[model samples]
Target: MGTYDYIVVGAGSAGAVVAGRLSEDPGTTVLLVEAGGKGRDLNVKIPAAFAKQFKTGLDWEYYTEPEPHLDGRRIYHPRGKMLGGCSAQNAMIYIRGNRADYDAWAAGGATGWGYDDLLPLFKRAERNSRGGDALHGGEGPLFIEDPRSPHEVSERLVDAMVEIGLPRNPDFNGPTQEGAGLYQLTQRRGQRWTTSDGYLRPARKRANLTVLTGALVTRVVLEGDRAVGVELEQGGSRVVHRAGREVVLSAGAFGTPHLLMLSGIGPADHLREHGVGVVVDNPNVGAHLMDHPMYLLNAETTAARTLAEAESPRELVAYLTRRRGLLTSNVGEAGGFFHTTDGLAGPDMQFLAGPAYFWDHGFATHDKPAIAVGCSLVGPRSRGRVRLAGSDPSTKPSVRFDYFAEPADMTAMVTAVERARELLATSAMRGLVGSELHPGAAHTTRAELEAQIRAGVEHTYHPSCTARIGSESDGVVDPTLRVHGVQGLRVADASVFPTITRGNTHAPSVVVGEKAADLLRSGVVAGGRAGQVA
Candidate 1:
């Protein structure tokens, strides 16, 4: 068995940051483990090639159980399986969500997690190309940049949004989030800047940090209620690694909870059903699964304004010579936040305008010139759960999003579709856009719209809140991220979010890692028992 000061179970967004931060002190030794290969694929570096990684070796490619509300359809959920996790395989959008998201968590039993408390960590971890401001940081590990060459179609869509009375806000991560604007990306000089690239890579050269790829953690090795170490499968060999300080689980929303259940730390009944002995009996371990449900509205373009034309020799040469052109696009180039109704806390609906036919999560692309807008319910009331399919570690978990189960969620989606249609019909989009290809004009009535929504609803790839941070009654982890009823174990990732953030979750996931590092470093070790961090 090997030992270390800290053992981080996933080398994704949060794990990368945690290991990198902890190893900064030469006296500390950190271990970061990943189940997938190194994130060195060309598809991971090119911002526009993110879709190509889906269902490939770099993706976990999880799917949810049939949803009753959506005609019993099983939605595809793709997560990053490589070193950088989803950051290396995502659209690279840099949005921190609305401030109210954090404040609400603070109000709802999560102490010390308010917007005011997290803003500094957000700034500290960001290296925005736009330079430092009250709301942004200029010099940090994660790089954020504007699109190198914004597609004309995306620019026109922004103008159309402004013409339709949506305010023109230059920065979504700034003071307010309610507006239409171009999305900043987690990129640098047109190349994707994944957390592994930004944080882990820098620390890999440090003698104190050890990174192991292709290591599949089977379960946490618990002694009574305290996590002593982990058992993993590396190269078809069973290996045990002990942690001297703590065992941090940054295995993401799905992986983390699945590992917990595998270690017999979840609901007692569920564990017994899977023939796994219960340890903690925490019913909330795999519950509270949440994600943003989205539907795409595609329209044919009159001119060659989409990425279809750019996938040519000329564009390829341009991209090879200088990291610019359509290749630099993050697919979902421009988007904005909007409220379906006024007087709400924040935007309930989020829109993304892509310069391609983004149907079926980009699994199938067309030769025709097209532009698509994604309408998603950012604040979904529908909650779901992740349950173990069996006790075997290799078996994928059973995920049920329970999407559209709440009638109000469908109502909001219907409004979002109408808004998307309006944006496509604007004067600015008159020449650029042609006939609607999805959910044609015939589906106008509420009943028809609802049917169409049910037929085409898909996930936004932002699954979170499975193992949330809250009080003991309804929470799995405390505010400091220490797992309830478990010693020497903590969770830091999107799963700990009390509520889903308003926009893409990439930025917030990285911020959670930065904060978690601080919490771990400053935490005081107490009398042979697990200590409190931050």
Candidate 2:
């Protein structure tokens, strides 16, 4: 292929938006490279059927090297390797998280990225089902829709929260986020709306944009100090593709930083350990890994009307004909955020209720009858890292997610699970709940709860902060998202989030892509000269 004006590596969540936005200029030529094949799986399109995609060929299926806090069980992490990436396989919840999250980044030396500054970009990138306004966007390429068939159990879940004195937040992405309510989905009608469907799909019709699926980018080829192209492996053949202007790294939190490190952009010591030559001895490249840690509080439910039992002919007919019923429900229907105590600045915990049991990573195949409510620590203090398992680019990297490494994380998780149990004890949830499954009533004491939390907690799958934005002293990428020691390249995605937000990260990740695109198009890098490549 010929040299393009811009080369966007990894056609995942953030890359889709970058390619979509940059190609809109018409004059600029953009190329998007995806490692996996087309993301057109039936399970990917069906909002409720997403769990089926896990561990499939389209998924990366990464597992963290045994977390010491989780009783030495290597938690399974399923990342999409398709065109839309995780967006194609994730629970379709749409959340912007707390506004304080953005403000905190600005306070941490990342200028012009506070809540107020980033709101416009968030609005510009979304087209909500409720339409556009000061808080939401309507005409944007990304489609955000309401849940199609929200089950009655979803309402009961919210009612249980209210019965336990929690307020009802009609919109989690609205003025307030501290309450239980039905969550909006990243869907368009009954179908899933991934970044590819919202952004890249439309951009493909444009002559200026070219999307190459199943193309594994091995490294970001650097010409001395400047990144000028990418080396990709296609059908066992190595090919070098050049970029006329700049290269954008939107390969997500894990992939982007991994690619950078492979191209000799991480710590000098780690580079030598992996037998890779050091180009820019940046010590903070793959550090500061943050992810949302959570645990499930399961109870056998008396409610016969659940997706768990909806495998009947009637429900099958409903799904097959009009795509309505319990089968259409996104497992996480109703959710909430609450403070562990009064006088706190924001919510310390979040809740996600599923009408059916999720034994492993998702729903089990057997006739196990249970309902689950999961609690996730919104702001975790623990940190971890991602390192090369080998020098080979195709090899999966070792992810050490040091969950509950901090006392605050364990405290928050225990409190959240306790709150969930307390809510179920209320009359609203008592009508449906039968008996505790994981940590029963016997595990109520502080010590017992703490132990259960340490043993039972797993990832909410919101891993970020590998290449976070901040001052050069503390981050891999600067406020403008340019890599610290690398020139002509930028990293955009959840990887750039200094601290992981308090809600579903998909919407926020898209927002980052939107803002990063604007910064690159406006010719403004961290030091004022954008096109000059650092």
Candidate 3:
């Protein structure tokens, strides 16, 4: 194959958007390489069946090192192993995160990445069903729709939140992210609208764009310090593909840093230990890994109001015919953001209320009707890192989340559990809800709650900030997303997040892609220098 203007590795959220937008000029050729096959699994389409894809071929099924804070349990971290990546596997919630998050990035020396600067890009990428506003876009490639059929229990949860003095926010992606309401989903007519669906699929018809699935990128082909191409394996054979202009890495937080390490770019001491040659020796390449630590507060219900009741032929028929029923639910049907205390810059805690028993990250489900509230400490103080398990690209990286390593994180989680219990105990849910399931009512003391948190806390499936954009002292990528001291190379993915956003990372990941495409199209190179397009 001939060299292309750009070689985008990993056809996930960011890679899809980058390739799609770069190829729009018709003159520029873009190649998107994906390690996984096309996401054509039947479970990928049904919103309610998302958990069914877990531990299967569609999931990478990465597990963490035993968390010292969580009773030495190795938590499962399931990433998508297909074209759309986690977007095809995740609960289709569309959350843009609090504006404060981006503003903080700018304050931390991400020059062009303030909340105001990225808001337009966010609007430009979304086609919200609620229509355009100063904050939302009406006609964009990615679709954001209201839940087709929210469950009664979900409605009651929102009502219960309102009853507890939290405002009823109709849209979490609006001006204020501090309230309770139904979650908007990345769906259209009840089907999932993944990045591959919104960006890559349409661009596939263009002759300038080439998509290669099952192509596992092994390392960046570097000349001195600049990335010129990539070494990859496809059809059990290895090949080197060159880039005329640049090579973009969108292989997600874990994969991107892992690949960089394999390509001899990472912490010098660690790479030396693994016998990998040093290229740039960026110390922060795999540091600052962050994720929302969550705990579930579940309760048995008096009536069969959960999704467990919707497993019959009638509900399936209703979904197939009109796209309305439990099948349309994203599992986390309703939720909101709330401050643990007053005067916080943003919501310290976020909730995702559902009608089903969500235990062990939805790997296990109760047979009877039950309602659960997922409370997450979104602003966790604890940080983690991803390291190369070995020099070989085939070996999975060692992921250590080190959750609750900070004492403040544990305090916030305890408060989160208490708040969720309060919501479930509201009068609106009195008649519907029964006894507490996981952390029983008997465990009321702060010490007991703290103990329960230690035993039961899990990840919210939002991993980010492994390779962030920031100042020269602390960041892996610059504000323009170009790797420090490396030319013809950039990263556009969740890994580049300056900080973990307040909500789901899917929307922000897409925003990164859109902005990266714009940066590349404008011929702006690293350090704000003008450059020629290939």
Candidate 4:
């Protein structure tokens, strides 16, 4: 057995930040344990090759056990099992969600998590290509850059939005998120930059930090109510390590909750059902599951100007030599947020445009001249749950995405799809596009669109809120993200978000980690004393 000041579970998106930050103080020792191997795959480094890494050894390809609400189909959830975790495999879109998302957290029991409080941390963690300011920070670890190549389709998409009266926003993470524009990716000089590359890589040189890859944690070793350490299976051998200070759970939305339940820190009846003695009876360990359900509208380009036409030897050469062309596009090249109606107070819909038919984001190869326009409803009113299947640590948790359970959610998605079709019908988009591939012009009725949406909508890859923060009687975590019934344990990921954000959740997840790191390093203190140097 070994000991360290901090034993961070899961070296994924958030864990990387915690391990990296805690190790910054040379006096403290940090141990980062990852179930997967080092994420050095070529696909991980290349900005556009992200799809190639899915379902591979580097991925923990989790699937929901046939969600009954969505035609009883199992949804594919490809989480990264590599060093950077999903940040290494994700589409690289950088979105911090709306300022209201944080403010809502403050209103809903998460004190010190308001927009004004978290903005500085967001700025501090980003090294945006656009440079530093009150809005964008440049000296931080994570790199955000413009795509190496911009497509004409993006221009057409933005033009259509402008025609519809939506402003063209140059930066979505800027002052407001109510416009259409090109998406800035998590890249550095045209290369994919993950949390591992940005945060952990630089911090690895610190003598106090020890990163252990291929170490699968089976349980959090608890001594009474305190999480003292972790038990991991490394090299086919079980080893235990004690934390001198704390065991930080930054294993992300899925992994952390699973680890918690496995270690007997979940619903009492469920733990008893699995024959595992309860440690904390935290009934909300995996409740309130949520995800962004998206409908993709495929259309053939009128002029073969899409990525489909550019995926040839010539384009490959251009990419290899100059880091230019379709290879650098994050697929979801340009998008925007807009209100469905004038009466709405905030944007309720988001469009994710791509110049290619990304059959499961290209997880499966196809030979269709397709480009996808994703229409998603922000702030879905529907909720779902994640539950343990059995007592075994290796068993995958059963996820019920319960998509479109609410009428408003379905209505919003249908309207968003109709809006996307209208945007495509505009003069600018008409000149750039061909015919609709999925729901053709014949399918125009609201019922038909709803059916099509129900049939075609899939996950937008943002699963969160399984371990939400709320008041004493309503939530699993408190204002500081600490588990309600458990001591010396906290969950810092999308799972802790009270409500799903209005955009891609990667940026917000990172922000949660940054904030959690501050809390952990400061002995898990809330506000006022937060952001102070150790």
Local distance difference test, each candidate:
0.88, 0.84, 0.88, 0.82
How far residue 251's Cα lies from its native spot in candidate 1, in Å, is 0.9
Instruction: Please identify model 3 stretches exceeding 4 Å from their true place.
Output: 527-534
Over 287-382, each residue of candidate 2 has an lDDT whose tens digit, in order, gives 899988878888888777777755678987887788777767788888999887666567878899978787577744436567889888888889
Clashes of 2: 0
What ranges in model 2 sit over 4 Å off?
A: 363-366
- Candidate 4 lands at a TM-score of 0.96
Candidate 1 — which residues are off by over 4 angstroms? Answer: 525-534
Q: Where's the lowest-lDDT run of ten residues in candidate 1?
A: 525-534
Model 3 TM-score relative to the real fold? 0.98
Provide the global lDDT of candidate 4 against the true structure. 0.82
Model 4 residue pairs with clashes = 357-370
Error of 3 at 80 (Å): 0.9
Candidate 2: pairs in clash: none
Could you give the C-alpha RMSD of every candidate to the true structure, in order shown? 1.6, 1.5, 1.5, 2.6
Model 2, C-alpha of 474: deviation from truth (Å): 0.8
Clashes of each: 0, 0, 0, 1
Write out the backbone clash pairs for model 3.
Answer: none
lDDT of 1 at 492: 89
Q: Candidate 3, 187: how far from true, in Å? A: 0.5
Q: Candidate 4 on 175-220: residue-level lDDT in tens?
A: 8999998899998777788999988988988999999998888899
**By summed lDDT, which 10 consecutive residues of candidate 2 come out lowest?**
359-368
